[model samples]
Target chain A: MALTDFSAEEQIAAVVAGETSSVELVAAHLARVEHDEWNSFLAVDRERALARAKEIDGLATRPPLAGVPIAIKDALSTRDLVTTAGSKMLEGFRPIYTATCVARLEAAGAVIIGKTNMDEFAMGSSTENSAYGPTLNPWDLTRVPGGSSGGSASSVAARQVPWSLGSDTGGSIRQPAALCGIVGMKPTYGAISRYGLIAFASSLDQVGPFARTVRDAALLLSHMVGRDPMDATSLEWTEPIRVPSATRLDGVRVGVIEELMSDGIEPGVRAACQSTIDMVEALGGTVVPIALPHAGYGLATYYLIAPAEASANLARFDGIRYGHRTADADVLLEHYERTRAEGFGPEVKRRIMLGTFALSSGYYDAYYGQAQRVRTLIMRDFAEAFAQVDVVASPTSPSTAFRLGERTADPLSMYLSDICTIPISLAGLPSLSIPCGLSEGLPVGLQLAGPAFSENRLLEVAHALELAIGFDDAPQGVGV
Target chain B: MIDDAITRHVARLARLGLTEDEVVRMQHELSAILEYVDQVQGLELADIVPTTHAIPLSNVLREDVPTPSVSAELALREGPNVTADGFTVPRMG
Candidate 1:
């Protein structure tokens, strides 16, 4: 059997059964990374990856993820590995400690293949904001792989690696996974620890997994979730989540958000989502119309809250500490000013300015304060909706992936691309994006969301739908 | 729309120096974004409280025990300029 044919779980099983060696599996993926046609990885750690794989091959009892090759988003710090976060500010900076999630994955014998690219400081919707170039979509090279986890999604779509880790603050993981035709899950906030992740809207940011199948994502999440002493907000799992084994969706209540299906959504995307709802109903499930009245304000509110927190969180990048510094300045103030101006991209600067203005003395009550109040209303809407249904469904994006330069010209239009996913982030709910069907020859993502800490149930529902859809379509010329 | 003066002022507050062109562009863009987000101003928030976090937690304290931490050398490894035991920076005015 070919190396690329096995799922992540199967790869682990093969190594345990002595059918394949970890070295061979790692080498096959490393070769793909070296010849990466999609520009997915920013830095390849071939030597270290092979060394780890060799070590795993020598072991008698294999771990859960032994010998599986996984890609990581550069936002997560990998000890002794270059983590650029797709910005020139920290272009060659290497962290001394690996992130908790990464450390756990490594402990499980998953070989870290390389670091993937992302939007500069995870600030933009499209990967075009990266200091490095944007990642091209594997489906259509002329189109964009969504961001800020574009590289992670594209790599998985191209089958460079079975799965990759991506961070989602506001739809970064889901939108890109939707565009790339893969599975992406943003677990309930604090479900995964954020110890080694470079901050990007800390309250909303959560590391997630991207894979070709929902089961693969679930396996990754099983290792990623757990309490961490390093991250104060991390939640401890009281008991192991029981993965539902039932194949049918009998007695399952799926809530279709009435507001999300209306205006701004493409006809094809709308039709595809409706068909998924029909599929659910036909599979012994009930579909009900749910209301999220305050969801319309989610994008606007997120722009304020995320950037406001980001403005404070990102203040540490001044020239005094780590990251890029300006040499032409003699005074401390000039050093800071020039360093930040020279380091950050346009989108980052825009957010900093917007956030600073919103939090300023005179405007705090109007912008940041009001955005917080609206955030409450948005969460309450979700709480009320969850009371009526077990899971909420919507299109992961309003439309399929657009051309590479399609939304780059206008930031507002780019922000609108995340309209469907942003509301879930604001409410800190668990949401997964799965390929429903083809729309205009491109894949459409059906988003399944549930109340906080409902990851197991959410995944179960998604897995059932995934089996029904049978979306095993891979990008052309990939994994053949 | 916010004026260029406010945009420049905000940039200064953010410790980012914007060029003339960037300031002008920021003025236009920030105005557009603010106008869009102004939709929140229409809500009736008389009794609604602000939500800073979805999960309610307060003062997450840990045991008062010292643990091994990243060495100063490793921490300063990524600094642009390093001194004998610390990071070097521009002199204050």
Candidate 2:
């Protein structure tokens, strides 16, 4: 087997066992990434990666991911790489510091292959919002890989890299992972420090990992979590995230959230999740129907809330700052308007306008305020559901990969793709999407979510189920 | 539904320069999204305490002490207009 196809753990063992060098592993992945079949990567530092790999080969003590080639989402800042969140606004912008998540990865001896493409500022459901272009799915070159973490998910799925990092703010990680047939996780809010992560919606954005295996996801995430003095919202967590070795779901309770399972879900997706649920029951786990009444309103509430925060957070992209500037404007007001108008794409402008209206006088109470209160209701719904179940399970996405441009024109249709995943974001929980099985020749994702700080338990349950399902995650019609 | 006035007003507030066509596009798109988000407008949320963030915590203050920080040169590295140690912007009217 090719070293590029090996699991992250196996790759690390190979490096440590003197069977191969870090340079070989990184070079192999770099060659694969250069194919650019899916337009997955936005930036790559070949020189640095090779040099870093050489450094790892000389290490007396091995770092956990020593010499392993991994990809990072553009949303996370890598000081050495140009970190544009797939927006023209930050086209040439290079961040002064690396994000806490990427910094942690480097410290653990991983060679960052490149920054993956994402939705502009992590705004869209598909990576189509990327100024460069959409990242096509590895399974079907014509289909979208899902976004704004589409590139991260697709890169791993296509085996360009064993694993990568992607930020989840409204299904960016999980949806793409599901659509691309991989394990994608968004840990609990504050579980990972947001120190250098470019802000989308401060309260909702959390950095996570994308991997081919549940255990690999667990391993990648273990090194990334922990409090950072650089970020105020950071939290401490149980270190070295370990999945239970016991591969049984005995005595576990799986709640299928009613709101996410129906209404817009493809029959194939529903059937795949149902079969996974049956597997849960077969493994001595009990399945229960859990109701989340407020979840139906998740999309609407998120549109108001996420954009409201985004409008505030994205205001920093004035012409004078690091990103793209307008040469046409002389006055400050004209400069601000024209620079952003020229720099940002359509989706971003729509959100900014929508958010400004929501927070404007005579509308704040009706829009942003109501959304927050409804957010509490959604949180309460999840809180109550968690009280009755160990973790909730649903299809990570409503349907499998949609052909590129299918829903791009109609923003609302694109927004509907996230219906199943948004409420979990609203509630701020540790959730993961593992490929359960194939439907209609495309892979389907079974989303498992738990209460805050339930990552260990969540990982254990997902690992057990992933073993039971044993679905192959290799992309067809694509060769590395 | 929001009209063009609100659309233009919001665009101005958000500091976005929209072409005549974009304003029309934004008007239609914003109107549709607002109508969709209108679902939350009728909910009786006045009685519920709003959640500003998912996790609840008081102050997130850290220890007050001087430490090494990013240099002015590094901070201004990506500035569109910059001097040796500071950013340069258009003069105020």
A158-243 per-residue lDDT for model 1 (tens digits): 87899999999999999999988999999989988999999989889999999988889998888889889999998887655544
Question: Candidate 2: where is the Cα deviation over 4 Å?
Answer: A238-240
In order, the Cα lDDT scores of the candidates are 0.90, 0.90
TM-score of chain A of 1: 0.98
Worst 10 residues of 1 chain A by lDDT: A238-247
- Please give the lDDT score at residue A129 for candidate 1: 90
Q: What is the per-residue lDDT of model 2 for residues A279-309, given as tens digits with 9 covering 90 to 100?
A: 8878889999999989999999999999999
Q: What's every prediction's RMSD, in angstroms?
A: 1.1, 1.2
What tier of docking accuracy does candidate 2 attain? high
Q: Could you tell me the TM-score of chain A in candidate 2?
A: 0.98
Q: In lDDT terms, how accurate is model 1?
A: 0.90
lDDT of 2 at A226: 83
Per-model fnat list: 0.84, 0.87
